[model samples]
Target: MGGFLSFVKKETLHIVRDRRTMMIALLMPVVQILLFGFALSTEINNIDFAVTSPNRTEAVRRQVERIAANPYFTFKGYIAPNEIDNALRSGRADAVAVFADDYDRQTAATERGEPAEKAVQLIFDASNPNNAAAGAGYMQSILLAGRQTGAAAPETRLLYNPQMKSAYNFVPGIMGLIFILICAMLTSVSIVREEETGTMEVLLVSPVRPIRIIFAKMIPYFLLSCLNLVSILLLARFVLGMPMSGSLAGLVGISLLYLMLALALGLLISTLANNQVTAMLISGMLLMLPIIMLSGMVFPIENMPGILQGVSCIIPARWYIEAVRKLMIEGVPFADVLREVLILAAMTAVLIGVALRKFNDKLE
Candidate 1:
């Protein structure tokens, strides 16, 4: 009994002594609860709603006021018919309300000679099928609020995904998850495994600078990640029948940049981890959850709590998924993805710089 108790006590002390183990044992549950509490939401809120009226009649103007008064929407002011496409592409609006030129005259009762036109047109960015559907429902309730018996339902159209396919949303999200999994987690583990087995020191003994040496180790993984990228694109295009509406070259270029950023992120992770297991643990704990929850993959960021939404801005996968969705699904031009590209580039540069500075010369 004494020996058994001693063994248990020794193991307990070992776990308590290892900070990483302690964090996983004690803090992981805390993190999971917090994320689930604030980040897991399907309800649509804070939709950026815009209105476009070629002719602003009293009826159209009054319907616009009704939509504006709704708590669910952020009422972007009236835009031109020509500006609707640009507004959606530029993220200026989530859904646009378009009124026909003779809307008021057409909606006039046929008790006279006039025919009733459709009440309004709701154009959604539909990259997220769920959001598009929910936004349509919300707009319908608002537009047809008092006139449920009289008004014609709003004419709803989904941009980018007229079919409203869920596949269009998840494919890019899966690509983001896979790129980070292969490039960052695998690279981190491979480098840390070398450190664990002392092979890293051998490679570092060469005349080359240590940063270059460490990064050279990442070359094979980067190539492997590229192969995975090609595989995903092929499957997404051929098997899934997803449309590649934007510039294929632009998508490929941005994907390569994302892969590089993932590689740098791996190098940074390896610098922090002492052993292969720790590297994998840190990668899973830090990278996986954020990629799933905060990357805007399964959940809409705008629906999350303010702090988690802000934290999402720093998550590399969030920007990658957004860019991919824009190019792959929405068919936005390369210029339209400029903001995402710049943010990713800045993140890559920062991670690489930190990894080089933090990498220690001696194996401790």
Candidate 2:
């Protein structure tokens, strides 16, 4: 017991005195959150479009005004009838809406119970899927609503992000995922590094129990992760104006629990890896890839093929990402996230057990 306490003290001292550990555990998450929030976004806003109306009638003018007034669109000067391809190729236009010379004739035909004699040409840039989809949806909604009620729908409901902003969704999950990467995989490599440098041997030869050494190495990381959670939430609220829909305390509790799981995973990897370099390589390829790919951080799991969806079930980050989004975006109750919390708890238990068994074997 005395040996364990002494080892814990020594471990704490090592962590606190080391600048690299502090930077990895704390600074990395902050930088990643900011970078991803700014660079990676799904929200399509103020997309430029070209309009070419050969007839330039009053109906076409009204249609152009409608598209221009929408928050999702910006008028990018008129395009010649033949310049639609050029405008799209030069990246000057996301879409082009062309009104036929007899557009009034079509409206008149429909009103007069006759066959429509004209149609509008909508040329879209399909490369930017989100923008294209938004542009199409906006055009469809405007025309449908105007033809029916002459206004936008007042009953529209956005399920997750009411503002339809990408930052709100991506930042929360990215923040959680980045912390997992830094905390779990990096901590694993750090412990293995000590072994490579002979520091682990020096500690093992001392009076410390293996359990104490493991827990001590993990304590600083745990604290750092908690601090990271607080900072991220602050940034999301203040910088990006994202609201936390669930209880802050509950979210914090879950974050700490996930951090512990990450620490155990690190310890498990540390025990298995022959050296620090191998540990980092293995964790990055094996653990990090699955977390980033399967966690639905950037890709929707439901949209993935059946085999990949089945594989995603085993990823810890998927649960963590889901929990974070639910808390931050959906404002779900603690009870709602209970199943995910339980699954995480079970995974932590297994990792800790595996780590302890491996450490025992190494000692023997």
Candidate 3:
């Protein structure tokens, strides 16, 4: 136990010795949190809204007033019916509320038990889907809220995700990306550094088995990655307001499986690369691009071409992120994630086997 502790202590010290790298690693998540908090948001706080009314009924004026008074929209006043295209094209309005010429009559007739179609039309700029969806929903809610009960036959109800927060989609992706990169890069670089510094030979000659040494070396990074996983979950739940709708134990179990896969992949990279730089290049750039582009992190895999989709099947983050979204967002049962768990376990076992084989050969 003492000897194992010493080995872990040494590896931890080695990891933290580089102040610059340590700072970058620690601050990277903070930067991501800031960017996700501010820049990557799809919440529609302020959207420009315009109105078009041929007859300028009191009902239209009241509706426009309500929209303008609400904080979600910036009322851009009324536009001519002919200028709808111009307004939308010029970006002068994100959405235009069009009222029928007989809007007042429609409302009055409906109140009197006479049939009348929808008197108001909502035209939105679909260029920004977030704005378009949110804006249209906002306007619909406002209009519906103003009407009496039974005035509208149908109602809109958003279940599970009522607010439509975009962070829910991003949190799992970021977690999958961040944990794998940090764990893999740290493990690979530490091993490669020992090789580069000529210290590996001295360690290899000692009483410890090569696999034991490699496993011991990986211990610190695994714990660190676990802490990182916890911190990420906390950030996702509290700061980002993302829900832990599923089982916490389930999330942790799956994440630890992914971490093992990441560390094993790092070992595999360390076996391939002779130096720290090469290991970092292989782990960072080579892994990052595929994870970001093909892992269904930022884009849907089903939408990709057959070749890219096939390529994505091999990316570890693809399965991990998919499992996370299911567990964290969709709140599926543990049984639901059996496929991801099985695939990741197989990948981890294969990587560990291959890495250990190469490591033993190199030691011999």
Candidate lDDT values, in order: 0.78, 0.79, 0.84
Candidate 2 Cα deviation (angstroms), residue 156: 3.7
Between prediction 2 and prediction 3, the one with superior lDDT is 3
Model 2, 113-174: lDDT tens per residue?
67775557788999978778877888877765554533334668888687777777677567
lDDT of 2 at 236: 84
Error of 1 at 40 (Å): 18
Q: Tens-digit lDDT track for model 3 on 1-364?
A: 6766778888888878977876776667766865775578767888898899998767777778888999889999888999998999999998899998888888888788888988899999999786788789889889866655474557678765677776777778888888778888888998999999989888878876677778889998888778778777888788877767887888999999999988988888898899989998998787988899999988889999999999999998999999998888888888999999899899889988998888777766
User: TM-scores across all candidates?
Assistant: 0.60, 0.89, 0.84
Which RMSD values do the candidates have, in order? 15.1, 2.7, 3.3
Query: Residue 211 in candidate 1 has what lDDT?
Result: 62
Off by over 4 Å in 3: 1-3, 43-45, 69-72, 79-90, 106-154
TM-score preference between candidates 2 and 3, better one: 2
Question: Residue 242 lDDT in model 3?
Answer: 73
Which prediction has the highest lDDT against the true structure?
3
| Model 1: per-residue Cα lDDT over 1-364, one tens digit each | 4534443454345445756744543343334333433454445778998998888888888888888887778899999889999999999999999888887666666425466767578999999998999999889878776345444555567788786566667778777877787678877886788788986677567555566555556665576667667767776777667889998999999999999998888988998899988998988989988999999988899999999999999999999999999999988899999999999999999987887667753433
Which of the two, 1 or 2, has more lDDT?
2
Scanning candidate 2 in windows of ten residues, the lowest lDDT window is 144-153
